[model samples]
Target: MAFRLTPQDTSFFSLFATSAGLLVDATRELTRLLEVQPSERNAVAERLRTLEHECDEATHELINKVNSSFITPFDREDIHNLAANLDDCMDHIEETADLIVLYRIGEFPSGMAEQFEILSRMSEITAEAMPRLRGLKDLPAYWIEINRLENQADKLHRKMLAELFNNSTDDAVHVIKMKGIIDGFENAADSFEKVAHTIEGIAVKES
Candidate 1:
């Protein structure tokens, strides 16, 4: 590890962990979309929106801390980028949940559960990794797992798209709505990978 002239401010790690914890909460709420009746979807979306707002607040706090601090845990730009990327993950998830309610989507395809499971796993591991940012210790495993999950998500996304297009009974409007939701979830997964990538960059630079 590179020598530091000043003791790192520990509060940044806590803020990062708080942001990641909200991600886990948001993804958990996403699972409710699969369980609830169509009428109940708006409630779930509302809950996710609330979580997203909380994440935004956390990001803002982190940024303000970065701006005011004389020294940071890492590069100021890296701290800014990490917070922005974490916020992006929440934004994508919230928007995806909102899409389902907006389109009044019903009976999510079975594959959506798999997607949710992958995202939940991603969020859980991300939250686990946040505290470790204090030392930039044992981070490679986190990014490696995120990359693997992302590849799995990519394959599943393509498979779901193919299946959606191949179904003969669904109407054009139905297919379009499902496609939008499918793409939305994929975007959320991609955002999580972006967070992992940002952390990996930080780890390499600090090492």
Candidate 2:
């Protein structure tokens, strides 16, 4: 545990928690993309876009707070990295939803729901972990679970790609579009892991 001689700004934790909570909301909207009719997908994408923008605002606020504050809970660089990575997670989720709408994808692959489910779990755990940054307690488990989930995402991604490519009926264009969406989800999952890794690094440095 790290001891601070001066009082550190604890609001950073609140901001981080808010940012992570938005990620959960964004992932939920992403999952809704799977449920809504194609005609209604645009609305869902728009909602995701809104969530992404809110995330951006939260990140910007965190950075601004960092710049102005004399004392922070952790290193400024780590704070910036963590905020950027959280934003990246939301960005990827929004981009994936946009692609689904832009590509006019009528049906999803079999494992897509599973992919979204993983991301949802990642976001949920991430939100849960943010408040713990105050003490940096019990953080290893958070990052460890994120790593495990990311591995699951990678394997599922490979399986999705193989299945997509193996399908003879899907046109080349269709395969390409599907690949883009799958890759986007994988990227989002990777972004979550990046957040976890950043948190882990902070824990190490502060411990």
Candidate 3:
């Protein structure tokens, strides 16, 4: 049997997944932008800014949904946590885009494009997982795959940062800024993994 839905549940999960989808789209765009030469950077940056604004609007809608709902599909705290985590994922995506513009990061660092690809893939996994909350019995296997992807993201992040710290010249500003951008990618993966965990919890709770 599946969990019963309320309008509140519908609203929350719809917006939650939409927010994640936008994050994935934004990151993918930024990754593609990073691959191009300087001539193509600004145009992608502008699109990313518009996408970020869309993400913010989606987030606010989610918060409003949470506030006005009478009861939620899960514990209020769990719902709140998941909503906030989704918002964090969106914010990190925006931050990564902003850094692409601020840093004028034309060409991607070695393997950086791969990391963005992984982030986009993981965010897709996460958005897919949220709906599985309604069918808790169906989630264990998917959560396992999501965990593996998150682990892959973790390993890739370590290598990406190692190169940044070791190969780049000793420019503190560069180090600090690149580190933050890299961290946003890491956090994006982490947030998606958390969603997997949240799904797992809902599975156990309902099963």
Instruction: Name the best candidate (by lDDT).
Output: 2
Models sorted by lDDT, best on top: 2, 1, 3
lDDT tens per residue, model 1, 89-171 = 89989998898989888788859999999999999999999989988899999999999999999999999999999873789
**What is the lDDT, from 0 to 100, of the residue 201 in candidate 1?**
93
Which candidate model has the greater TM-score, 1 or 3? 1
Which pairs of residues collide in model 3? none
Top candidate on TM-score is 2
Over all chains combined, what TM-score does candidate 1 have?
A: 0.97
lDDT of each: 0.92, 0.94, 0.74
Worst 10 residues of 3 by lDDT: 1-10
Off by over 4 Å in 3: 1-9
* Per-model TM against the reference: 0.97, 0.98, 0.84
- For every candidate structure, what is the RMSD over all alpha carbons to the true structure, in angstroms? 1.0, 0.7, 2.7
Residue pairs in steric clash, candidate 1?
none
- Can you give the lDDT of residue 146 in candidate 1? 99
Ranking by TM-score: 2, 1, 3
**By TM-score, how accurate is candidate 2?**
0.98
Question: Across residues 114-180, which tens digit of lDDT does each residue of candidate 2 receive?
Answer: 9999999999999999989999999999999999999999999999999998874888898899999
lDDT over C-alpha atoms for residue 183 of model 2: 99
**lDDT (C-alpha) at residue 25 in model 3:** 80
